[model samples]
Target: MGTFASHRLKNIRTLSNQVSLNGYKEPSQSHPCEKDRISELPDDLIHHILTFLSTREAARTSAQSHWSVNKWTFLECIKLDIDWFHLDREKFCNFVDKLLLSRDNVNSPIDTFQLSSHAIDRASTWLDLAIKLNVKVLKFSEDRRWEPFYLDPNLVVFSSQYLKTLDLSNAVLDAIIFDQLNNACPALENLMLSDCLMEVQQISSSSMKNLNLIGCSFIKDLSICSPNLVSLRIKDQRMGNSSSKNSYLVFGTITLIDASNVEIMELSAIDSMFTFVEQDGSSPMFRNLRSFRLGPWCIDDNFLPLRRFLQHSPMLEMLFLKLSVTTSEPPSTDGETRQERSSTAIGWLRSEASRPLITLWPREKPLPPPPSEATIAAATA
Candidate 1:
């Protein structure tokens, strides 16, 4: 076996040198003593080394020898960032197709598959292939230049029992896709949905441990029932253009039916009408919560809800209050002036004396001294 492996490796090195002439420059001929020691390694060891290289680098190296083609098949991770393809959509698709086709006979599982592309018409096929390969960590997104891509969530046939993490950005999702995720991906632990269009009314999962929903504008209500969830973050709007209208209305309430296991939670840009619902009346909502962050939009003129939320979290240790300047002034009303509202909010902040409070505000505005016992900080961004 040792002799056979050595001979195979030698043949691969010779082929690699010939293939390298296609695009990459060939190295100057050297004495046999100065030849690459890497080429002398066993096939398995060479494949292990190739796995550390980027997809582009691996492809370039594989072109140098016909034997190196087998090394690419042993790769467990594939990341095709199409930006490097120079926006050649057809060429990118063809390359991916050929790569997968070549590995059609290989039964090795793909540990990670991340693809960022502008051409998403064939995304379903690629996802199907990844599922067939038993992908564990899957991240799919369209290029930043285009609007959010609409994907048929049902198209994701998650036959892979090994799937643990899923991240989808700038995509459209409906109730069916959420249902499929809950039923198909039993091993899913972490899920991140960012800047996407959501048509689902409820997002429930039993196996999920961490859930992040950021800049999802279309979700009207969140009904999470992940009993294993330890961390949760929900942000209603994106940073830029706060005035931009969404296709669908923002969530009015977040129903934590079975989220008593959650330990850390963050809420940002939540409208005043939004509230929390605990299905179980016997237990307090967020009993395990230790860290809580309330974004600027989460607190409007009213501080009662914010105060009530903090009061429920008895074991809370770290508290973050992100305050932002509203671009437009509130319309004059006979009920209460802006100054009064600000004063009332400040009074509520002073009342939370038990926890360590960290106040975060924009950098453009001068940082005021710490309020009484609270710590004043600026936004890291």
Candidate 2:
């Protein structure tokens, strides 16, 4: 023990002598404590110094640091991608548990909390904790193709009073989500759902302002009742498929039960327009509607849907028609090519000075002929 102590002293003395020979000043008594003491400084001061550190250098601090306070806690934005666990449920839960538990005392509210959909059962627990922490924007992403995680009904009952945006991908949701949001998340205004499936057919939300749906399917006929909704956009994710249908989106009925106030609406699907109707079969006046975008399906259906909208939405201002190079499944059998059919839709839109101005764009590279001079004015006549 004495020999070992002597060796350590000799090495220190040699280092000191080398510093002296190099004209370097010897470190003071506080020099040894400066490294750890810097971390004890004000958070803002320490954060500024930390900004100069490279990501690799910063990562070193995470080593053996899980138990350390003020590390992963106090985060304003928390995004947990569970793929790192490789489906190890125990580790995933443990990681999320520790991360959220550490934030129990954080004063700042979480701005966004994102979790991957692959986090199977315990997702509810993590989500509940995030909502309890006053998460403002909650999002979930798809990890497994088309696999959905249930938004626990119990969790939804007390989700968030401050949530403003709910963005979900590859999630299995139902009308319960919308029905329950009114009381628990009164502030939610924008709802974006993609690659998801609805177990039920009806969704009713009174407060949504903007709704976006992409590549979504429903088990039965679909109905939406959002009286306060302003902007509604539904896009067909499967655009170029030869089949007349989108496998990701299967619905027989699409009814806007109470969207009379919607101003800007865009529908891109195989049959969304033709199937669109009010539940009462009466034309509910979209008195505030200003802009409407339609896809190729309207022309394939002989402009029946277009006619319905033009007649019902008296205040409709601008119309947009997006045509794919090829028509989707159950090819139009009226002996009229899609190009010919579109000219009729466009010709009527062009001839009418009182009707909404129609803007046309093909999904393909080639452009079609100019609007036919032989106008099918019957559409808007």
Candidate 3:
């Protein structure tokens, strides 16, 4: 036994000597991998990879030392959705604060920056940073639980020349902001405002091609002048009957004055009033219009406005009308309503020479049956 033990010790010593001579280290003494190939990637390439991930995920990755400590600042696109924070407002705020702080030294332009959060009041710094970065596409949305988020008008003074597209939701806007946008963002193309509180009376954009306003209220008089606009959509949300004057819902007048170049227009002002003011004595002619959608309110006042509006859209090829039927009445006994609609249709056809394709959609709690053969024949006749 003793002889065997001595022989084993001698063999081990001989093996160690051979390893030293060959300059070969044991696997246990060396790193699992020779080098971190991932970390060795170029900063720009790593930034591109981080752009595909959410802001939270990117921050976590950076914390793990997979990339440079400040590699996230090199990202061209930053999308931070508060939903990922699971209502942890403090954590979300901290993350955003740290992110902007880390990019303080970065002069790189951000291609896109989108942030959706409930606490928009704390996002002024974020917006400032975005503007400073010369962000091209910026979208800021707030939770609709409380009052509309009020944006600081002073921030609008620092107009970003690189801003091309802007989208805001559940915010308060005024004329100053619009004027600033028109002057600052020369390349602005698309603008969208949804569920916003409007304090502005006029929205004039020479460079804008697409404008969308949904559920925006509280303007005594509103006028839109976008000669280069190709698409416009205005929709109003249904509001309850309340005596409170401070309610966000208020009926207002809207005028589309210089939308002659519009190709597609969707107007839904069921609660507010609308008028198409002509440039001169002539009607506001939509020379390039191809698609038009009229909401239930279009049929108000016996569809007079709709008929008159159709006269201007001579090139219109498609028309969509949304009609609401009273569910309180029996579906099979809508004879009066059908007759009234048929007569209105006949009047419209006689007034407008263009024979555009018309589609009617009925909306209510209970779905109404399709028009009977007789009803269709009568309408066609």
Best-matching candidate per lDDT: 3
For candidate 3, lDDT tens digit of each residue in 1-381?
Answer: 356445533433433333321123344455476554545667756665665555555555555345555887767788887776676788788777777767766567788889888865677668878888888999998876656777877654438778889998888887778777767778899999888888887778799999988777856688888789998988655444422222577668888888899988888666767787766776457878877777666765566778778868877776767565554533224344533563476467656555676766554322123334464445445
Off by over 4 Å in 2: 1-34, 43-67, 83-90, 105-108, 117-119, 154-158, 239-248, 271-284, 327-333, 363-381
Q: Identify the runs in model 3 with alpha carbons over 4 angstroms from their true place.
A: 1-37, 66-68, 155-158, 237-247, 281-284, 327-343, 350-353, 364-381
When summed lDDT is taken over every stretch of 10 residues in candidate 3, the lowest stretch is: 14-23
TM-score of 3: 0.77
Full-model lDDT for every candidate:
0.67, 0.65, 0.69
The TM-score ranking, best first, is 1, 3, 2
Report the Cα lDDT for candidate 1.
0.67
**Once all C-alphas are superposed, what RMSD does model 2 give against the true structure?**
11.9
lDDT of 1 by residue, 183-254 (tens): 778899999987777777676778899998876765556577788999988765545545423345445566
Each model's number of backbone clashes? 3, 3, 0
Considering summed lDDT, which 10 consecutive residues are worst modelled in model 1?
Answer: 372-381
